[model samples]
Target: MQKFNVTPLLVMLGALGLTACGSSEQEEAPQSTKFSLGVSDAPVTEAAAVVVCFSGIQLVGNDQPPQSFTLGQDSSAADTNDLCRDAAGNVIPNTRGIDLLQLQGAASEALISNAEVAPGNYGQLRLDIAQGSYLQRLDGSRHPVQVPSNQLRLNGPTLSAGGTFSYTLEFDLRKALVDPVGIPGYFVKPTGLRLVDNSEIGHLEGLVAESFLINNQCNVNPADERAAVAAVYIYEGLDLPIAELADNGGTNTHQPYASTAVFFNNDATEYQYAIGYVDAGNYTVAISCDTTDDPENPDEVNFIVTKNITIEARQEPHQLDF
Candidate 1:
């Protein structure tokens, strides 16, 4: 119920060639290869539902300008669901963006299935999103979400002739949504996004006991605890200097890669956090619970701890406790 359909809008765009990828009128028809692109999301804590409505996906390579692919809505696939629809009451595909948060536990919704393209050195992949996408708050309120330029250009994986390439476009909602103070709605920043081979990423899940709080108290304000999780951050390198985290949770710097809010699961009795799609490499996990009252230099007196971990390609997420 979190997603809203914009099928007529998508069909309208496709008719105008606005979603078309290539425009070469005299280009020869080369033997096309197949590339399967899917979309997924890292867990976010700001809202109950993060819905994005995509209309088309375009693949750009060295041999061609770009090739457009239709996103049909099919629910049989693991990534496809009933969250989208067309005028005929059929589930639309890639054309309708999904609640990336809904496709979790390494699940990805297929964006392009067996998309045919000129086999060559593909450099970029572009995704076209509809203008109707919005975020649904926990209290059942909806707010308009902004997309930068209405498209995302990602580094594409190469597709060899007569071969197939598969990749998943992972959206990091924690870092992507900018909730500026005094701003009523959130803005979607695509720069924090990344595309990775489905086999080259790992999931990280961990637990934070209630005693993990700063001086036995949740550092979060009393009014902000209604959501499912508490704030937790992830960085790329080892331990990051306190100066790097000096900002008021601003992720303007490039050091911080992704973040997830830890959920206080009622059944588990612990704060559980999960990073659904992380590239295989070294990473530092940080949790900040203020132990001091200083607001300017909060990082100096917070119950912040960093854990260095190495993730292997396709390895099952191991529990990292604090």
Candidate 2:
């Protein structure tokens, strides 16, 4: 069996506590509301760290002026403000540097807390990315990550008055982060990005039995070691055929909604995998030891285990083991 290393990157932004502000003289002015926003990521292979520095965030909607915010100067979360610090431990003026790999599987870092904005439907949310974003490989080599336009524009959700709303922006790096043919640095595309309401999302986790790995002739690494010899692929609908399951590429008909590597956990003494920020719905989950999945191209892979599962909004994580 050919052991394949699998890694996927996800960016989740949860917004909460949107309360209306007191109005005064300007009846025509839009009512202001408060919301909290945070970011999180899934695991990745081959890279020790993927750091992105966000300079600012902008919200554009309702034909009103764009609401812009600088990272530290705005109402930043105190606890997570240190995440924007530089090598000398001083907070960078307007940028927030986040290590996406450090936050995996239900873990997140707060960016802005109780930030005020106009209450209305927003069509675009722009992330102003700074230069110097880079990826550090396992071998300790660092390469710059180039964002095409220095910003990422994602579809925004509607913010109503007197109600709290949470949303997540998922970035599937497997299909979005790519290396150019002759370019020296890596590139980040907007292809695999998605924005979903957090209130309608749930989590998924499970263990892969040792006997199952052995039966499939997988490389059973030590329990204490971390290796991506296997992986779990998740599709949006249930009972999907194993032959039609696809990678993270765009052209595939059955492209995976999300995927994560299965690695041995020392604490549990079992191989485990966890996928977070999944939209609540029916899904088909498949496990493969011969996981030679290439996000840029469709590849033939053999699945040893397949099952159907349902996820409910705000419910406890669904577990499906092989």
Candidate 3:
């Protein structure tokens, strides 16, 4: 097994396109006017913008696509990228989601109800993931999730009658037809770090690392093997990637950083709350552990924590979280 002897570690952390007819900016005139754009998620890292395309336009950013806005990446924004970010604590750029058409309306109308809207010739977008009456009327067809909204087809210059206006879209990103996989409630094991090495990158201590499927809060049960089926990811810190660790071999990112992970103990229970293998030194340690229901009801949940943690054996295949 791998071990961390020293060094402080931290960390934790995609999209599609649409088509359009316009080739370039219109020559009608460069209308000089200050405009503002808003999406459900802003520059958690990247600057948020409304990308206008041929067939339709939608907002995207902070690692989530249009349909994924309602979805939570992690139980705690401090722990995970809110579930939007990958194991690394960085915010994935493409996660921004698109609004459904049912909620579409003029910025002028929504401003009255919204405090974020600034008074002006606004171009607001509200989407409903559902197959609403307005969506059918606007596109004149039933659009698959892959299809972009028709609003993008509308020329930006002609969008507002007034020269100055603000836009806001409150469309639903969740599919009303299917059950949500993750709800608002969830917890972690040895969250963030597990205090492994005190030197640089702590030498591997050879601790056993095990994984389990738990409810909203991370804890294992003897009779309940059902939760163990959920996928779980192991990490050193919310900010560090696994591929960079010592044994991991530095292949996690564009330019791999030195990274590694190890089993916590002889028994699989070590992976449960154990922070991987901590080096023999003084340091802060952390880990990210999560799972979701196969057919998530997005309703009730609970937490489980024990002193001597051991899992029940079962014939069913165990699932791994990516």
Winner by lDDT: 2
In the range 1-322, model 2's lDDT, one tens digit per residue, is 9975443222111111111222333455656677666676656556677887778878888679998877667654323234444446566566767887776666666666677776888899888877767888877898888788999888777888756666666665655677777889788777766676778888888989888898899868753354466878889898887777766653556878887777777767788888878888999998887545556666666777689999988747778898
- Tens-digit lDDT track of model 3 for 1-20: 99975433322100111112
Q: How do the predictions measure up, each by TM-score?
A: 0.72, 0.82, 0.19
lDDT (Cα atoms) of all candidates against the true structure: 0.65, 0.72, 0.23
Error of 1 at 231 (Å): 2.5
How many clashing pairs in candidate 2? 0
Give the residue spans of candidate 1 off by over 4 A.
1-32, 73-94, 180-184, 214-216, 219-228, 242-254, 290-303
Least accurate 10 contiguous residues by lDDT in model 1: 290-299
Highest-scoring model, TM-score: 2
In model 2, the Cα lDDT at residue 299 comes to: 64
Error of 2 at 88 (Å): 14
Q: Between 2 and 3, whose lDDT is larger?
A: 2
Query: All predictions: root-mean-square deviation over Cα?
Result: 16.4, 17.2, 25.8
Give the lDDT of residue 123 in candidate 1: 84
Clash number for every model? 12, 0, 89
